[model samples]
Target: MILITGAAGNLGSAIINSLLKKVPANQLAAFVRSEQKAEQLKKLGLNIRIGDYNDIASLDNAMKGIEKVLLISGLSMERLKEHTNVVDAAKRAGVKQIVYTGVTMKDAAVSPLKVLMESHFQTENYIKASGIPYTFLRNTLYAEVIPFYIGDQALNTGIHYPAGAGRVPYVYRPDLADATAVVLTNKGHENKTYQLTGDQLYSFTDVAGMLSEVSGKHIAYTDVDPVAFEKHMKEIGVPEIGIMISTGFAAAIKQGDFEVVTADLEKLLGRKPTPVKQYLKAHYVG
Candidate 1:
């Protein structure tokens, strides 16, 4: 059986749906925290396993007999103890291949997400030590996440974030999901690290231009200092931790760390990844 944790979440659901097209639903097991979520997934014709990372025994039972497992990263910012439970349970369950969805902050020396990198590296270490073959899909920023920051507000006020007009190497989640499904089903992808991202580089100014063209609304891009950007986020009541993460990532983008594209994702999926503007038109315009 192939187990997918966080099966109720957006990324997990996308991955599960993609995998279902290739593998039988019964051959796929979904591990979620809540009974409501389990019921929902069951209605979709999935094998349900009730488990939570907080409860190691539940995780252990849920993972038993699973050949390949996808450990979708959790959302709990300050509380990462749950990730530990998953690593231990997967270890004991003797899972054959483990695929992890991780952030693209791989350069430990110059990474903006210094604090967040530790958890991903720790998980990577655990997978390496587990005696199970592993694949790390080191994902870039989501394309959809951009609209949440620059969308309707730009439509109304004509101005979006002023993070020095940096370029973002946004990755489409559905594309990432497709690439991941290939690894889960196909062989010879073990112990590989894939930095998945979009086919093109897009700056914030380019984003504004795309939105304006699509929506027929005039939008302007402003360059704001990092300090001022953080202050703006705070004045708008953005959580401190989230602000730090956003600011650090924005700084990194401005420095051109995310502009490079790799063929690893396309080679795995047998197709090209989605472009940023097209994704925005599909997601935001309609």
Candidate 2:
């Protein structure tokens, strides 16, 4: 069976939905951290298994007889530790192939989000060392991150963020999910790392323009100091930790860190991924 952790999450649910079209329901496993969430997945006629990265015993049970596994990165700054737990559990469960979602530009030794990239690299190292065949989906910034980052403010007072004028190869999570499910179900992806991204690159200013055009509002991108940005985020009740992480990503973009879109994504999915403009319209407008 193909096991998917974080099954209740957006990307996980999308992956499951995409795989269902190509694979049988009995061949799918929804690995969740909570039994309550498992119940939600159960309604979809899936084999729900309770598992947590922290609980090795639960992970072992979740992976029983499962040949392929999708190891969605756990949320939080402590992603490295969380992934280590997953790697250990997968190894013990004797899973054959593991597909992990990592970040794009992770090979760069130094980046603004070193903490985040290092976490993926560390887990990638563990997966390789375990002697288990693995596929690393080195994904770019999620296009949907914009809505979460600025939607409330845009709805409130038309305020946005510290995105500056930098461009990002903002990928849609659903597209990434499609490619991820394909790799997990198909062969020849073993030991390969795919840098998944959208069809083109775009900037925060570009996003604001699209939103303005779509919503027929005068939304604008404002530039601010990093310190001021964090302060504003905290004042707006964004957690201190979350402020740091978000600001760090913005800083990375300002340095032209995540602007490259590779051919690996199209090669893997055997189709062109959606463009950022189309994604913005589909998700934000309609």
- What TM value does model 2 have? 0.91
Q: Looking at candidate 1, what is the lDDT of residue 130?
A: 69
Question: Model 1: residues >4 Å from true position, as ranges?
Answer: 78-80
C-alpha root-mean-square deviation, candidate 2? 2.1
Residue 16's lDDT in candidate 2: 90
Per-residue lDDT over 142-254 for candidate 2, one digit per residue giving the tens place of the 0 to 100 score = 88887766664563356456767778878778888888878988888899988888777788778878778777787777766788878778897988778777888878887
The pairs that clash in candidate 2 are none
- What lDDT does the true structure give each of the candidates? 0.79, 0.81
Q: Name the regions of candidate 2 deviating beyond 4 angstroms.
A: 106-109, 153-159
What's the count of clashing pairs in each model shown? 0, 0
lDDT of 1 by residue, 187-233 (tens): 98899899887767788888878878877887677767768877888
Poorest stretch of ten by lDDT in candidate 2: 151-160
Give the Cα RMSD of candidate 1. 2.0
